[model samples]
Target: MKEQKGKQEGLQHDELGIKIRSNDNPYLSADLQKKLLQPRKLSSYFIVLIESGTITYNIDLQDFTLTDGHLLFAMPNQLLTPPAKTDNLKYFKLLFDENTLALLPQQFSFLVNPLNAQTIVLDSAVKERVIKVFGILNQLFLLDKQETDTEIILAYLNTLLSELNSAYFKNREPVNLLNTNLSKFIEFKLVVETSLTEQPSINAIAEKLALSTNSLYRIVKEYSGTSPKDYFINRLMTEAQRKLRYSNTSIKDLAYELGFNDPDYFSRLFKKSTGKSASDFLPRQDLSGE
Candidate 1:
């Protein structure tokens, strides 16, 4: 929670692009702990492993409670509102960017969050292993940057993610990395995220993915439980909500910025998607505690 001029509000790391903190960390002073109560726009992949107690976190405007043996994952660009109280909370928090993730030996499909489940309930064995890995990573991070071995850190990181990935998918339909339809679905999501402002037509996206409209619909439906068009619209509305919450841009400008030719049309679409007006969707000053 160190303050950096002109930087976004959040817990930032050193030049190594990774940070790990636990309840026992001596560096986590009282003032720093107080700062954690503020809302932050996450710039990296973040995970919180709760060892004891319970607290509710507001992520992207939704509240999720975590107690002992629970893990919460938040991806980049999401809004993270930490709990106001942590006096009894024992937790280990980890943050790493995409650059660090790319260095890993294997792809973590759960990082993409295909199941849309962010909180994973860890069993006793997995909880102990996760805590041990977190403690090792914390010790590694505490060492001087020059003395620390990046490879060792990565190896532990890989192991931690592997464990979490297994627990995240346990008792659920496992994701097949080699499944062709799933691959296409992921690619489709990437394409949508990249060209979201362009608001490309479903046919155009299907063509780009080398699939017919019907095939695209089936693929998206199979993966996301929605048609391709609805999926795109939902993504757009989500983006609109993010901007409205984080930035001071007006509705008209936001609409145009999001590729809507007419602000009124965008207004109607937002209402239909969110059941609230764009202005009403903006974060309240009192609630935000700004």
Candidate 2:
């Protein structure tokens, strides 16, 4: 959907305290502005692939430039400056909340985290497939206006995300899961992506995958340098950032959605994770259009 005229991803802000904002949502009406839009941070993560023209993204005070077929991945809340206005720019920008992205397998999820600067500028064919995803989104959305059309459109969205998981992610050239047994590492991450909030503790996560907590922790620390708890929280906060910045949901409601029993506690935890109060980061806040 066209989240807002200025933002691409989804809701500018919601209760979750995450914003996956984008310069242009998938379906851009021809009537919309075509110039290089000013750079801004969204509520969710940034997955941008430039098809043509000059697109510059400043991450962590460094400007990364891209031309045709270059990919740019920005993690949550990375201070970014908009590209200098220009023309001849064709790009696909995907802004997905941490909640949605946590649904992604670990092997691929880290690709976008700012902590990892491994930007994979795929060959033309891979770039085409990535662009095709948005093509599907744009086509379904740009057709005739009807509520039923959106349901079909959402199905298309699911297809793109699923394909991304299987093609580029699961089938990639094999690599060791850091140092600890790779198979166990992949398994643990897989379960977390599938059922994030569902995992309660280290023991519970280990039990589901047929391993002892000690085994899991040893490997988790070996590869990722963090315990399972820290890993899961990272993913959870990713979602929180997307929702809080984009949607209309309130902080209390978003906390409840994320499995928090107390909205107040959720607020405190959110502050710890993002260093900003839920209300401070909310997009298009409760203010009404005049």
Candidate 3:
């Protein structure tokens, strides 16, 4: 939860980079809880299933309250922070690096944007199946062997993820051609992320995705409630906020680093996007005073 750089205690891993930890782990402690509640970016994909209790978390500045029979996901590099008070929390956390995900037999289209959906509500039947699968994964990671049985682990892992994918789509709208819409949206996100620094035009992105400008606008708004242009600007500003909070980069350098030709324009855009000035976005040194 504290964005573990390498291996962590009680974090069993394989050469494939799969890691798992649950509420039952002895290494889960108060400090780790504190870290979980603080804003941090992970180096791996993180998925947590809430078997019981409730907690409100912020995923990319969007608030989501997850309780029993709910699953949440945080992609690498996204900001994840929860409130500190979670005495009743009980959940299972699974972390796997990109390489591990690549080894999967299929692609999870949901991982691309996650659709601003931090949590998925599971019905009772699905919840039971989810728990059983998580149990298998937890046991696999707790083995005492020198190396994990990758084949068996991957089989179960694939089953678990496949079940999750099915469950995730189940609760969403039963629209016609969901796969097509989802694919285009995912491609749009990829283009936005990859060309974020260059401040790519919406039309260019639409062309790259083989989408008409009107179609791109409709798809983005349908999925994320924002236009393509606004979404791009927001992503850029989010990156700016991340740098301001976690790095020592100055405003001018940060602006240029984010692909802004004019530092003053970047500053103005930041202020407009965040409703706060550049200096105001910086991390505060005195927490007690705040």
RMSD each, Å: 7.0, 11.9, 6.6
Winner on TM-score (1 vs 3): 1
For residues 41-158, could you state the per-residue lDDT of candidate 2 as single tens digits? Answer: 4556666667787766665435688888777766554545455434667776666666644332343434333123435566766777767876666544344334333234445556
**Best of the candidates, TM-score:** 1
Q: Alpha-carbon error at 120 in model 2, in Å? A: 2.7
Order of quality (lDDT): 1, 3, 2
Of the candidates shown, which would achieve the greatest lDDT relative to the real structure? 1
Q: Please, what is the whole-model Cα lDDT of each candidate in the order they appear?
A: 0.81, 0.59, 0.75
lDDT of 1 by residue, 108-226 (tens): 88876778889999999999999999988887777554565566677899999999999999988768766889899988988987899999999999999999999999989987889
What's model 1's TM-score? 0.83
Taking all chains together, each candidate's TM-score versus the true structure is 0.83, 0.49, 0.77
Clashing residue pairs, candidate 3? Answer: none
The TM-score between candidate 2 and the true structure equals: 0.49
Model 3 poorest ten-residue lDDT run: 1-10
